[model samples]
Target: MRERAVQRQDRLLSLVRRRGSARVTDLADQLGVSPVTVRRDVEALTGRGLLDRVHGSVSWPRRRDRPGGGRGPDAEDLVLGLLAPSATYYFADVIRGAHEAAAPAGARLVLRICDYRPAEDPARAAGLLAAGAEGLLVAPGWRGPGDQAAYSDWIAELPVPVVLLERSVPPGGPLAGLDRVCSDHTHGVLLALRHLTGQGHAAPLLVARADSPTALAVREGYAAALRALGVRGPRPVIGSVPADRDPEGFERAVQELRSAVSSGAATAALVHNDVDAIRMVQRLAELGVRVPRDLALVAYDDEVAALADTPLTAVAPPKREVGRQAARLLLERLRERAEGAGGGGTDRGMGGGAGVVPAAGAGSVPDADPAAEPAPRRHVTLLPTLRVRASCGAGAGTGGGATG
Candidate 1:
């Protein structure tokens, strides 16, 4: 901990030890902190069994007090449980949006980082439900190759509603009844292709994640975009490169991308995810192949895409809006379930008024009264916008010329 923080904490403990208890205002006056800060310190110290909070005052932990505390089920105000593999990148904005929407909707959106599972993935939703989460907002769990279930069946067995976030639901796939909110990644591929081809770059290589749930949709969209544009050439889709946590794999992928552009296998490429695109852009820079000058590039997700050395042209999923919509969608369901339950929401004690869901969804004012027209359904497929920048060779002066 920082020295100042330790000093403040120490001062707090010392005061409690000396006086038996100290009022929050008195500690704040002595410690150069606000009463709120003193109270927060008291709370933390109490959590560690270093002190006890005694009605606006703090005292040394009593013999009756045991820290590293316990929370009964009733203490859990967790209404919606959100789980995603990584905390940063694409999901951060999603989480932010979820929180923003959940507050007005009167729901507490609890977050859990889905960590690496040794034998099997954790019961991501069940544990949340056990902790009194009313519903779940989970990015579809990563499964093995060819294990094709869009929204898993096991989630159906769980008693709560499941809303898949930022993941695809295959057409004619299972879970017709499931609620999901995702950016149309396939449409993003088409957008990138059209942008590149419109600028006279024919047969650009498409890089993608082979083992991902969204890969099939991306590949299908690439081919469809190629055919729809009537562009004729040996269209290449490279899936040998991976999108994983390993830096080595990303570096190898970068080398592979560099080789493709350097050897003239493809002058331009559209990579599905931005992390690989950033690494590839750095590698290409190292190889003295300038983006938009030697190799035109486009990334699917815009997260950190613009931060590339060349400021990559990318198709960015509206992630925050997706998150906002996901929350609204879940709340809409909760609302309907409320109506179905004779207007008293199932978890009456949970959200009170904070979880009051807006009827017209995230971006609009309600048209028909929520009671009149049907509450908005939960499934939402948000479209992506193509961000034209230096890397794709489609912005301003770069638009007319692609090195091929």
Candidate 2:
């Protein structure tokens, strides 16, 4: 606790030094703390003569002999652009994580909601750049890998540094050179399958959607996990959505699950996304099928999965952490760019946003090779863990961690 408080104070000092002066309310907001906490820290710094109180604001005690007399040139005042499909849903946590990291480092986030409009992403990003976005964190609205891969060319040609958030291109594809951070849905699938199979359930069926990139990844991962685990039987993949979106499709999924269970073709199932899984459970209940009695189930995306009547076991992706790491990576990219361009006042000495290391994930470039200079292009992939619950017939902590 003491260490964290000290670190926070150091960041507080850095921000004031970089900007020359900052309001107390703005400091609290930027630090992601309360006004009282900021006031306390300010008082402590003022006692040491490191800061000067000026009305409702604070300033560095030292004076400047010339203009631009701060720590480094353009160290503060970074405008980072973020483009996501939606502000709600999963991206909300991602945006919050990015904002939390950006604010403390004196960077402002400019968000652009594209609402799955892939064709409009470039235009929106270009507009952000025109409005003085020095760096970008973009989660392109891609329905699938192919859809995102198609837009790689334009993304690569953007003048400013770009870091992909929750999105990536194929290996050796157009955007391979770009930095990206995303959840390892493949590992997420592996977690769900291994958990079900660990309890002696073989060849669990998969009911998923193909409408989003995450859904597609889960579908593909299910196939690979089955082959890897050598669990053989009638493994079928059913496509589905919420009941209201497509009643016929939803009915087909429920019927498929019912048939599989009744015929003893499968005794367990893994469903992608919480909504579909929850709805499937509800419809199956109407048919007199009880979860964990006749069919053990696990759902992907822990969001609201636990709210079901059966309290679904789920594979939880690190959504918010993906945003934090992506933002931190973009800040580093900006610093590197500034330094390479001979910006003497660059924030080279300042610790990049939040001082947190990126979590390792799939396709991640290893950092063990000290001789590798200039840092290889990163594809940081965060793994997902399985949350055990009643639906999967698991007792407390029966599921495995991400490493498992």
Which predicted model would earn the best lDDT? 2
TM-score of 1: 0.67
Regions more than 4 Å wrong, model 2: 1-74, 341-373, 396-403
> Which lDDT value does model 1 have at 17?
68
**For candidate 1, lDDT tens digit of each residue in 291-359?**
888888988778888887778888877889988988777766555554453123332212222222455
TM-score of each candidate? 0.67, 0.73
Candidate 1 wrong stretches, greater than 4 Å = 1-78, 116-122, 147-151, 171-174, 240-256, 263-265, 341-378, 397-404
Candidate 2 per-residue C-alpha lDDT over 1-404 given as tens digits, one digit per residue, 9 for 90 to 100: 45365456767877887787899999999999988999998998677455789888998655321254323213555668898988987788999999888888878687878788888788777656643467789888888657875765677667666788887566655566577899999888888888888888878999999988888888889888887888663665888876888899889889988988988888889998898999889889899888989999999999899899999988988888998998888887766555453122322212221112235633332563333223445789999888888898754346333335
Q: Assess each prediction's global lDDT (C-alpha) against the native.
A: 0.65, 0.76
lDDT of 1 at 299: 87
Error of 2 at 219 (Å): 1.0
